[model samples]
Target: MYKCFLEIGFEAELSTHEDPELLELAHEMCNEDVATRHIACAELRDMIYERGECNPYRMDDVFLLRFLRARDFIVPKAHRLLVRWCNFRIQYPYLYEGVDLWALVKIKDAYEGTLLDRPDIGRLSIFRFGTWDTSEFPVEDLVKAGVLMFDIGIRQPKLQVLGGTLIVDLEGITLRHVATLTPTIAYQIVSLLGVTTPARLKSCHIINYSWILNTFFYLFKRFIPREFYDKIFFHGYDLKSLQKHIDLECLPPRYGGTCNSHAPFGLWLQKIKKYRTAEFDKEMKALGYLVKE
Candidate 1:
């Protein structure tokens, strides 16, 4: 059926809910897979109960709301997906604990793609999200959520970018790389940050960036719309750095904004502790091909 939908362009939007990510959440209420179905639906329910503020970009809140018009706009699969996982937990309620959530993330060198949709450090800008005090605990689940960076054109996975190049840092050139130590590094850092996890990543988004204003604006003295850019298409880059990049739309961005503003570091463990859930899963099954540096 899904294959058929592909030919017909049957598109289904995902709500901000976390359950859909489980993949099994798509299983129908009547489908019979026993363990698979039970785990999928049950776990889906659990994720919802544990749900806090769903990322507006990832999942939609409206999907949970049944009948926006009282009779129309029913989202059963959504409702089921969002909360079924929780149903699995009624027997034993537990929260992720004792895992160091603040795992140091090393962005791997991108062999072929681009990175997009990563942490929103702008909000976390020391001013807004507040700085972390090791004495306090937070940001564990967020650590678990990892990141969603766009891989514009690169293809190879898992090569850590050693450091920014002379052009990328000084001239402000954008380079792509894979995260060298997602699972392995997570092992070390999570132990330090103190949060539990299968240590799996949340998701990955792919997009592009451009440096526009740096090329123009001073002459026009007038403003250009940022939407006017020519290269980047996917949304969510740092409003600060993205200004440097002009999407094909040619719109001008705020002077200080660009996608580079995306958070570079992990949140403090103190923040992750608040909504921690243990039943989610623990024990990182370490396995891999580490490109020896």
Candidate 2:
């Protein structure tokens, strides 16, 4: 059995030997000076409100800090990102509108994986993408499913603060599966995850990939931003290489780890369903009457 460590709120045991540049950047952005950070956060919040981009919600320090850190403390850029996020929701009402939990579960299970479970030791959420029944749902529905997952992640303080990882196991994926990833769909996926959302993508590991998959990914990479491009790691079935970056204890048994027995996908999905559904409900209710003024 895998040992489970309970973490509370946004706090986690992060690495002490962080990169100096990143350490410095964190200080410059939100850690070094408390009073200055507050001032900057408040200014950005006021700017967001004044522009009438989104409905009035509590722009707490933690919330503002996410945007600030995402844009490297550039208030205008962060504000723009925040506006784009809100606008995406407004434009894609069907995606964010009345969500059906069972539908989400269907999409998730159809892929033979789950994304709602616990984070790794690095305090990063892990998504295992196994065999997917592509015919079970349209690509748009799949994209919406992704949006829902990301929405939950961005809302969670721990995920927002620390970011997450994605492990795509292509063991069972075939050319037929690759066909579903059209250029348009690829662009939409990249835009939503890389550009719109506030969640930081720590790393994306594609394991058990084939040459055909690599070719497709090369095309997909063109649509993603350069910054995010660096985070993509191709293991090609090399679990040892992957473990070099991520702890073995954090992964499921299928991925050569000990944790799967402790926290199965079903249990994790249930917890996420319960929590995300309520959060989505609250957001929709809050913005229920909001009109694009």
Candidate 3:
């Protein structure tokens, strides 16, 4: 039913549904062949059990498929990712434990970070550090909110296959803000997304950056993988430079684009709420996260 994504350079029409064309694309790009996929999932489950992990992980095909796709269907690599992710959860309980889906309204209300209304090659999310008030909202709370966002966003199969893009707008970033991102926080943030998370990040656009933000990136640079490092583009307040990758019309008005109307972060959260399944709640509860009824 989705006709637009057939061409090579065409932007994918974002939908919760993954049509046949996307499946074919996954097979071509992500090595998701039909026959081997079943075997790979089974093997990954076995590998996890062999590790003698005490934590309860969702070992079903649906949950396991994300790691497999993230690592290009390599079972061993997928297995490693699963283990690292489980370990990451144990390492950082503050980010996950007692996190309430509704309680994050304050962070979303800040509108510091959100996905744009339109979809480019992948879903375009903007994180505006300029809007963040560190005094009111601790950097740790932002990290907690980010973890929640990732957990929710990763449930979409379309996002898993097509990947996503991030725009980190560093306008008005002060030294104080940079100070908040200490080496430990930097390492945790980098390791959480880069090392453990199964989500595919197509590219990261750094716009509205300054020397202060440069210091932060310098700290973040070491933890970034070489492959991921190549995907980082520094626009440094050049909207035109950003437009080269993201079309002018597709961008919101803040970034010098024609699209004026945009969905607020809370609205997007409401829309994605349906993607949260009973199984998700169970997993969260197992990890000592309180999922309110």
| Best candidate, TM-score | 3
TM-score of 1: 0.22
Lowest summed lDDT over 10 consecutive residues: which window, candidate 2? 7-16
- Candidate 2 per-residue lDDT, tens place, 1-293, comes to 12333311211222122345544545643343444778888889889778887753558886677677666577898898888777667667677565553446565442222222343432334433444576766667766666765554455444444455666566766677777878767766776654877766677787887777775686578887787878888888789998887776666676787654332333444555443344455653554321121
lDDT digits (tens) for residues 151-254 of candidate 3? 76676676777677777878778888888988878877777464788877777898877668658888999888888877889988788899898876657788
Kindly give the stretch of ten consecutive residues in candidate 3 with the minimal lDDT sum: 5-14
* lDDT of candidate 1 over 94-194, digit per residue (tens): 22222232332321121111122211210111111112232243333323323211110000111110000000111222221111223433342222110
Score residue 216 of candidate 3 by CA lDDT.
Answer: 83
The candidate scoring highest on lDDT is 3
The lDDT of model 3 is 0.71
Cα lDDT, all candidates: 0.23, 0.59, 0.71
List all candidate RMSDs to the true structure: 19.6, 6.5, 5.2
Position 268, candidate 3: lDDT: 50
Each prediction's total of clashing residue pairs, residues at least 3 apart in sequence or on different chains, is 95, 1, 0
Task: In candidate 3, list every pair of residues with a backbone clash.
Answer: none
